[model samples]
Target chain A: MRHTINLFLMLAAFWLLNSGHYSVLMLSLGLGSIVLILFIAHRMDVVDHESQPVHLSTKLPSYFFWLLKELILANISVVKHIWLGNSSISPTLTTVKASQKTDVGKVIYANSITLTPGTIAVDLVGDKIMVHALLEENIQALETGEMNRRVCQVEN
Target chain B: MDVAIEIMSAICLLIGSFLCVSGGVGVLRFPDFYTRMHAVGVTDTLGAGMILIGLMLQSQDILVIAKLVMILLMTLFINPTASHALAKAAIHNGLKPVLDNKERNNTESESSSR
Candidate 1:
C-alpha cells in the first residue's frame, strides 16, 4: 500500500518535472498517462519493496552523499595514476564478502563498488563478489568493508 | 554573486573535462579490459556529475535544474549497473584481470584468517 503511494508520487513528480507545460489539456493528459502506467505496473506486480524501496527513502540521501565523497576520492586517485603512467597502476582482482542480507542490498553494495572509480564488481556469487581493483589500495579499501557496512545500514 | 557562481561553474566544467580526457588516456594506456572499465567509470560518474552540476548552477531555472538533477540521478544509477553487467559478461567470457601477486596473497591470507 505504501509502495503504491510512493510509486504514484514518484511518477507524478517525474511527469511534472519533465513536462514544463501547465495547460489544462497537458496536465490532464499527463495525469491520465500516469494512471495508465500505474495500472500497468499494478498488473505487472512489481510495485513491491524492491521496486519501490520506500523504506530506504530517508536513508538513501545520506548514503548518496557518502557515495559522492567516495567517488570524488576515487576519481582523484585514478586521475593521479593516469597522469603518472601505467607503471603506477597495479591491477588486482579479489573477492569481497557482502554483508547485506537482501538482494537489493547486495546489488547496492556491488553497484557502489563499480560506481567508485578504482573498483569494479566483476561477479556476484552468493554473498561473495569478485572485484577488479585498479590499484592495491582499492582492494585494501574494500577489505576495510566500510562501503559494505554503509550499504547494510541503508537496507536495514 | 552571479560572477562567483559563474566562476565556480567554469571551474567545475574544467575539472570535469580534464577527468574525461584523463579517462580517455587511461583507457588507451591500461593493459586489460577490467582496468579500462575503471577508467571509464571515472568519466561516467564524476566527470558527468561535475559537468551536470556546473550546468545546473548556470541554468538558474527551477525546471531546468530539476531536469539536470534527474539526468544526474539516472546516470549515477545506470552507469554502474551497465558497467557491472559488462564486467560480468567479460568475466563469463573468460577475460582474466591482471593481478598483483602481493595483493593476491594479502587477500588470500585475509580470507583464510576470516
Candidate 2:
C-alpha cells in the first residue's frame, strides 16, 4: 500500500542522502531491496502507518523564523534580568489553551514554549497545558495568543 | 584561493575545538549543575555552530552544503530543547538552585525554627 511505499522511499532517501559515495549499482540494488522488503510487508499487512497532519510545509520556515525572533527576545529579557541580579524568581503556573488539533502539533508547540527561557510546560490537560513561567511577562506573552496563532498557521 | 580558504577553515576548527574543550572543563569544574549547564549550553552552541560553518565552507558541492545546513538546523532545534527539558525535569524533581553557604545556613535555621 501507500504506507509501504512511503516507508521504503523514506529509508532509501535517507540512505542515499547519507551514503556520500554513490554508485549507480549500489543505488539500484540497495534501494531495490529496501522497496522489495517493504512490498512484502505491505502484502502481509504487518505495517500500519499514519502521516503527519502539519500540511503547511511552505509556511514552516515563516513559523520557525517567528519562533527564532521570540527566542532571541526572550534571551535578551533573561540576560537583562540576570544583569539586574534580582532573584525574586516569582514562578507562576497557569494553563494555556493549545490551538493545534493534532497531537503532534500540540507536542511541538508545548516543547517549543518549554525550550524558550522562562517558560516550562508542567503538564498537559487535554487541549490546555499547565505552564510554569519564570517571570510574569512570559505568561502575559502566552496569554496574548501570538505564539498560538503562528503555530496554528503551521498546523493548518 | 583554496589555500586561503583552507587556512581560514583550520582557524575556525581550532577555535571551535578550544571552545568545546573549555565548555567541557567548565561542566566538570563548575560548582553546581545549573551553573555548569549555563557554561556548557552557551559554549557548545557557539562551538558546534562554528565548527559546522567551517566544515560547510570546506565542503565540495551544493548537496554537501545543504546537508550541513540541515545538520546545523537540527542542532539549533535539539540543543535548546534538550537543555530546557533537563533543567525543567531537575527543578520538578526538587533540585534546588545552589545558594551560598550563608544563605543555606539561614534557610536551614529558618526551617528549623518554623
Candidate 3:
C-alpha cells in the first residue's frame, strides 16, 4: 500500500507538471490508467528496490555534478583530437582488471569508459576488461581509476 | 532574460553542430582508421550532448523535459557501447597499431645489438 501510494504520487506529480496539452477528459483517463499500471507493477514487485533503487534521491545532485564534469572533459578531448591530431593516432588494445565487486558497478564502469573519448571497452570478462584505445594516453588515463572510483561511490 | 536564454541555447547548438561537422571531416581526412575513430568518438558524443542540452533549455514543458532526459539517458548508454564494439571489431579483424618513433627506435636498437 505504501509503495503503491508513493508510485501514484510520483506519477501524479509528473502528470500535473505535464498537463499543458491534455484535455480534461484525456488527462483523467490517461493519468488514471498510468496510476493503475504503476500500482499493479508495484504489487507484482516488478519495480522493486534493486531494479529502480533511485531511493537514494538525495545523492542524485552530487552524481549529476560528477557526471557533468566527466562529460565536459570528454567533449574537450574529442575536440582536441579533431583539431590537433593530423594523421598520427596510436591504437592500443589492452585489458584492464575490474576492481568492483557488483555487476551494476562493473556495468557502470564499462559504460563510463565507453562514454569517454578515445577509449572503448570491448569486452568485460571476469575481473578483466579488454579496452580499445585511440591513443595509449587514453589507456593510461583509465589506469588512474578515478572514473571507476566515482562510479563505485555512486553504486554504494 | 528569455532572449538571453535563447541566445545561449543557439550558441550551444551552433557550436555542437560545428564539432559534429569537424569530427566528420576529421574522419575523412585522418590518415588511418585508428585516428578516424578518435576523431569520430569525441565529436559525436560531445556534439550530440551539447545539442540535446541546447534543446532542453529551449523548452519549458514537463514532458519535453522528460523526453530530453530520456534522450540523454539513451545517449549515455548507447554511444560508448557502439564505440567499444567498433574498436573490438577493428582489433578482431587484425588491425595493427601504428608504432610511434620511440617504439621503432627501441625495436631497431634491440635487433641491431642482437
Candidate 4:
C-alpha cells in the first residue's frame, strides 16, 4: 500500500513535469491515466519494495555524488589512453567478489563498474562479477573493494 | 556572476565536444568490440553528461533545468544496462577479450571459443 502511494506520487510528479497542463479536463484525464496505470502495475505485481526502493532513496544521493566523482576521473584516464594509441592499453578480465546482500545492491555494484569508463561488468553470477577493463590497474582498483563497500553501505 | 557562468558553460561544452570526438577516435583506434565499448561508454556517460551540464548552466528556466536533470538521470540508469547486455551477448557468442602487454599485437583477438 505504501509502495502504491509512492508510485502514485512519482507518476503524478512525472506527469506534471512533462505535461505542463493544470486544466480541469487535462488534470482529470491525467489522473485517470495515472490511476489506470497504477492499477495495471499493481495487477502485474511490480510495485514491490525493490521496484520502488524507498529504503535506498535517502542513500542514493551521496552514493551518486561519489559515483560522479569516480566517473569524471575515469573518463579522463580513458580519454588519455585513447590518445596514447592501442599499445598503451593493457586489457584485463577477471572476477571481483561482491558483498551485497540484496539483488538491488548487486545490480548497483555491477552498474557502477559498467558506468565507469575503461571497465565493463561483463557478467554477474551470484556473488561474483566478471569484469573487463582497458587497463590492468583498473582490475586492481576494483579488487580494492572501495566501490563494493560503498554499494553495501547504500544498501544498509 | 553571469559572465562567470557563461565562461564555465562554454568550457563545459568545449570539454564535452572533445570527449565525444575522442570516443569516436577510440572506437576506431581500439582493437576488438569490447575495448571499443569502453570508448563508447566514455562518450555515453561523461560525454553526454558534460554536454547536458553545459546546457543546464546556460538555461534560465527552472523547468529546463529539471528536464536536463531527468535526462541525466535516465542516462545514468540506462547506459550501463545497455552496455552490460551488449557485452554479455558478445561473451555468450564466444567473443574473448584481448588481454596481455609488452608482447601484445592485435586489434581484434583472432580467436573464438566455440
| Best-fitting candidate, scored by DockQ | 4
lDDT of 1 by residue, B1-114 (tens): 999999999999999999999999989877668888988998999999899999988996899999999999999999999999899998899877766655446545655798
Per-residue lDDT of candidate 3, residues A1-156 (tens digit): 555566677777666655555778978886877868886896787775444555545655686677678777766766666676543455677889778877767877787777766677777889798877766787888889877777667776
In Å, residue B10's CA in model 3 sits off its true spot by: 2.8
Task: Report how far residue A23 has shifted in candidate 2, in Å.
Answer: 1.4
Specify the highest-TM-score model's number.
4
Candidate 3: clashing pairs of residues:
none
Model 3 residue A142 CA deviation in Å = 1.2
How well does candidate 3 score on lDDT at residue A97?
78
lDDT of 1 by residue, A107-130 (tens): 889989989999999899999999
Q: Candidate 2: list runs displaced more than 4 Å.
A: A1-10, A32-54, A79-90, B1-60, B76-114
Chain A TM-score of model 3 comes to: 0.74
- The local distance difference test score of model 1 is 0.89
Candidate 2 lDDT over B37-96, as tens digits, reads 644553545567679989987998977887887787778768767766776788779876
TM-score of chain A of each: 0.96, 0.73, 0.74, 0.98
| lDDT of every predicted structure (CA atoms) | 0.89, 0.67, 0.72, 0.91
TM-score of the second chain of model 3 compared to its true counterpart: 0.81
> How does residue B27 of candidate 4 score in lDDT?
95
TM-score of 3: 0.73
